[model samples]
Target chain A: MSLAGTGPRRDGPARGRPRSEAVERAIVEGVMKLLEDGVPLAELSIERIARTAGVGKAAIYRRWTGKEQLFVDVMRAAEPPDPELPGTSMRDDLVVLLESLRLRGLAGRTSAILHNVRAQMKSSPRLWTAYHDTVIQPRRRVGLDVLRRGRDNGELRADVDLELLNDMVVGPVLVRTVLRPDAELPADLAERVVDTLLQGLRPS
Target chain B: MSLAGTGPRRDGPARGRPRSEAVERAIVEGVMKLLEDGVPLAELSIERIARTAGVGKAAIYRRWTGKEQLFVDVMRAAEPPDPELPGTSMRDDLVVLLESLRLRGLAGRTSAILHNVRAQMKSSPRLWTAYHDTVIQPRRRVGLDVLRRGRDNGELRADVDLELLNDMVVGPVLVRTVLRPDAELPADLAERVVDTLLQGLRPS
Candidate 1:
């Protein structure tokens, strides 16, 4: 909160040299810890983050414009690399992508932060846009690419909208996460979800 | 936020008879109004609800156990009745159901409350369970019945998991609502969603 003010000249650090990578990493790590601890967004202040990160408030201000900006950076940094799945078939690709998401995307701090973001997005549009652009869209692009490959290879029907197809394949995992945070996602969840979608997309 | 204390004897009201429907209506109305006006859940106190509803604190306490219970009642009251769509075919039934959900479920105060609940569920498991049981499950049952009918008619392949089938059809709308809150769901969205699912489930 209040990482930077909304002044007219709300650019990068007002008058300081760029901080080192070490300092930036510390700040991002601090944010991740707080989110994992299930700290409500309202209570996550810049001052507290500075203290936790062992950096000065001026250092945090020098790096990002505000809490939302900082959150975007943390999410981007924390995002796991796209899985290196073999392009064996559409079904195999989707299963690997989704299982990676469940194991890495929804694991530990990332899962906690995502839950917090879903809850807070409606109330904070600016933050939502930043998070979506920085974190969600990039990951989504990977999913889209997979579907596009399937369509191009004649593994999937050409007529279906790729965006809608993307949602169909991936949406259930997200919905399940939101509804039952404590429940274990079945080991076969990704396989089952993909099979259902692939059946819909198979060329006639 | 403190609707009721977590005391040992935290049963229903300690004394007095059940409140009248008029008083109950006022309180529920107050909760709806505040949610529509964008009051964050953390700031939504029972005292404020009492003031907005023009009812005494004792009146609210007399009926429900806490804010969570009152919220469940409001959601139950606000839910639109299931659409009486013609059971023309599986595709038609699904389109009508999804459209009704978009029009009624994601509109106005109900939409706002849903966004709030998604955010608050982690912090308030008891409230989440109450809301899901009272509001979400009943609507879900209607969707399940539609799938059951489709299977019985031999329109869909019998081997598909009915629960997963329901998620495949309905999950996209919920995901879209969360990701892009302001975007209009296309008129053809439901038809397209159903078509995709049905293709996968078509009898061999």
Candidate 2:
């Protein structure tokens, strides 16, 4: 795995300046294109990605250790970047986190590419674990941290289970996105989910 | 689609006793056996299922219209039956509905058969629609009816969106079951979720 801030390592013969950003974009987009066209992940190879990207296998190798690393990069490139928390309040931060989820769900509709790619990824244990570690866990940690802060600051009831709370807060958005694909994701979905949950279902 | 109550049609020459109960069980179990052994749903045919169940093709056709109808029955037979909602209270009824979902998630771990079979079903639009109509929609309708009754009886806030509330109440269970398969489904999960939501997150 490449270090986040250290930049791409220029190890192979292609080492002069850093790799062109255009080349990187092209490779990532090419993988996305193949996935969009219904190419199953199991069928994708470094050779095939290089062919589609119009680059040599060496070029792909220069950037990624292998298919798994490249796939992690592909998912990162595809998702909406992680939310920038406002530090204003827990409620505000949660809305930003959920809004990002809503956008990903909307974005996933393009060729339903993410949905297809994820399904294929889940079929292989190694690939799915890679994705869960790199892409899923960190984002989840962010949500948990926010909830922890909320509980400590007395914004949330101390007795509440943070893990369960995290699920309750995130679950509605996921239900719409993953399970109920036909359901509309209104623009105010994030706010509605947050406020409704905070206010409790019982009338005051 | 065989009508729920109208027993098997006895039009076929071989049918004298409305299809033996033992044979019906065998056919459904046979389909499940194939799925459990990792047979792709797309590859299953009536003849293949008949061969596995040790019944003739005629026996299957006499029972089901075709693959889609048979698949629906398979899903139905596999799922824990819909809860008999306790007419006690809205909260109690919601818990019953969610407990059923919890059981399903646990049941699904066996061979991960439901997860795999559902994934395959979604790939085929026609088949998925049949499933959505027969299995998914009815279950959703039951939840909605319970919510409606709750609102009417003043057990729920009058202004609540029943649809959204349904998703909110059901979402956590689905998250634990479907999204975060690693999460524990504790014995009191349904009660905990309901009470927490009713109490809200805001500190009293």
Candidate 3:
């Protein structure tokens, strides 16, 4: 999910001095810390971010446009590279991947970030798109690849729609995690969901 | 979905004169209109709501504690009574119920209201609880009844977990409707979801 190279390039190189990677890292780290601490997006100011990062305002603006871009950059940097699960059985692969999502949702910071971003999405479509493209799309591609393998291996019915199947497999976990954050997801949720889906896709 | 009499009892009868149903309806309608027009929840003030409803400020306060309560009341009032699907078959019943959810998501006002409430849930726990109790729980009970009938009639595996099955059948629609509001649900989505579930549930 790291979009380090994928994000919009900085507008030209720094005018007077070479860009400092340390400062950039500091800024990104600062943003992450603030978000994890439950700072509302509205209150996340460029000045405060700079202060938190121990960087000057000019240093912060040199690499990114504003808080939205900074936030995107921080998330992109923090996102772990997509896991390359070995070609195990589809059930095993899906369970591993979906369980990771479930666990991530349970993490306090990740959960807060997701909730905040979702709340701000309507107000900031561009930021939402950036987050979606950088974070969500890549993860979905991994799930899609797993399903495609199942189809090719004849584990799934030939006519099954991979896209719909992806949604079916992943959607419930997401709904339970986000909409009902207070409720505990079933301990065997990953196993149960995959079983139901695989049962549906098996040749009758 | 109507929770007219199911919500917490109003504190005693109206103290001064009788509560005006027309005024209450007007306030609810005003809330709906503002939300549909895309007014952010932060901007939806009681003063503005009063003006929009063409009722005195005192009229609203007399009934609802504030905007959140009013929102719950309005949604409860506006929500149509759950349809009785003649129990022709589990597939038919689920398709009807799920499609209704899809249609509700497509409706501008309904969609906006759902998003608004979801965004505010973290900040307003009590309102969220009211919504969950009055709106979400009753609908879930309806869905649970359908699944129960399916199990009893031998359309589903006897060992199937009805609660998990309910999430599987309904969760995808919710995820699509809420998370990916921009994407149109496939026209045959309800049929496809129900078909997949039934295929999985059949005692093989």
Candidate 3: clashing pairs of residues: none
The local lDDT score (0 to 100) that residue B102 gets in candidate 1 is 69
Q: Could you give the CAPRI-style class of model 3?
A: acceptable
What candidate 2 keeps of the native contacts, as a fraction, is 0.75
> Which sections of candidate 3 miss by over 4 Å?
A4-24, A36-39, A42-51, A55-67, A76-81, A108-123, A201-204, B1-27, B30-70, B77-81, B109-123, B201-204
Error of 1 at B189 (Å): 1.4
Candidate 1 RMSD computed on C-alpha atoms after optimal superposition onto the true structure: 7.2
lDDT of 2 by residue, A119-182 (tens): 7787788878888887888788999999999999888999998988999988998999988888
> What tens-digit string does per-residue lDDT give for candidate 3 at B1-204?
124654323663555333466666788889878877888766889999999999988777767766667777766655554567967987789899998888767763355575564666546777678778867887889999988987888777787778788888888888888777776687899999888766762234
Report the Cα lDDT for residue A153, model 1. 82
Error of 1 at A151 (Å): 2.3
Per-residue alpha-carbon lDDT of candidate 1 for residues A1-204, written as tens digits (9 for 90 to 100) = 112232112465444324456677888889888877888776889999999999999878876767778876665555565579788977788899888766753563356575565566536788777766765676788889988888888888778788888887777777666544554567888998898776663234
lDDT of 3 by residue, A87-123 (tens): 7787789888888777766653355565565566546
Candidate 1 vs candidate 2: the DockQ winner is 2
Candidate rank order under lDDT: 2, 3, 1
Error of 2 at A2 (Å): 7.6
lDDT of each: 0.71, 0.83, 0.73
